[model samples]
Target: APRCSRDEAEISPFCSLPEHQAPRCSRDEAEISPFCSLPEHQAPSCPVCCGPIRGLATRLPSCQRSRSAVTCRLSGTLLDEDNPPLVLPSGHVYAEAAVLRLEAAHGGGAFRDPRTDDVVTMGSLRRAYFL
Candidate 1:
């Protein structure tokens, strides 16, 4: 039978061997961690968070579908080339200076009218922008 006891081996693996094992200290003790330690956590933010932002927020000369994959109007001319109207996909229409934010179902993005500076429904401005 081996002379070394389990308790002694548990305390020190090197006890049976000629070389001494590294020390094991409590949290209070300052000791270097293992060479290959796992990280605590990863970055929570994802690139897809702004997926809708890039799709709808950008200034599109014509109408296009948003990241949510919804066809909507981004901008349009209200009174011919001289005046323009801004509309969003939500169905709300504004003349000037109105702000509209797309919901999660829509695209989870924000749209502001350059002409009226307002938020308008996406459907309303499609023809003017696309055509």
Candidate 2:
């Protein structure tokens, strides 16, 4: 098991070993911690914590999905340059023409989110682009 000073353990519990294996010492004793062999909790074992971080980074990745994976909620199709994509404040995506028609159907006042019914406006719609 990697070692960590008590202070390091306190600051980042993930840096320390299991509870049963943790060496206990009186706060006044100033004894060496079995985990880190340090007089006081100061140093941290980077290996232990780095492993978890790297593991999570591998298990869950980012920016791996392509733009074609994004589908418009209104049209139920992949967003394209011809139709373009618009995003509401509520994070709902729709084709530009579809948003215009929906807003016109609502008489051009504050529009409501189809899913949550939160009021938004056509002007509040923002264009979405992916690279």
Candidate 3:
């Protein structure tokens, strides 16, 4: 039987048992083993495991679907140079007049983005310039 290392013995109580008495710690068994309770054996956080700011980089682009084809979510009409699209803070694109009308309907107060539920104001809307 293979001997447990000093560090492994200290972390795993089963390591102290005799070879014949001890149950094998296979990779799958280790997941549910009592040793997993140790802080050092815990899973790493997103930042630690993936590197700082990697989460943001790995995230899918919010406007990926809209970039390929432009359409107003509010008016359900194809967007063109004549009726340009404006991008909301939540990344949804809508017709400029449609957004203005929506804002007006809410008494010019902050409105909730339908896609992500993010609060947005007319001042924060920007033109979508895909290149």
Best model number under TM-score: 2
Q: State the lDDT at 38 in candidate 3.
A: 52
lDDT of 2 by residue, 1-131 (tens): 54555445544544556767655533344432355323232222333224444333322212222223555656555677877898889887778767777778788866667767887887888888898
Best by lDDT: 3
Clashes of 1: 13
lDDT of 3 by residue, 35-109 (tens): 434544333432212345444322312111223455675676667787789988767788877777777777786
Candidate 3: segments with Cα more than 4 A from true spot: 1-69
Clashing pairs in 3: none
lDDT for predicted candidate 1 compared with the true structure: 0.35
Question: Given candidate 1, what's the lDDT at residue 67?
Answer: 29
Question: In candidate 1, where is summed lDDT lowest over 10 consecutive residues?
Answer: 40-49
Q: Candidate 2, which segments miss by more than 4 Å at Cα? A: 1-69
TM-score of 1: 0.16
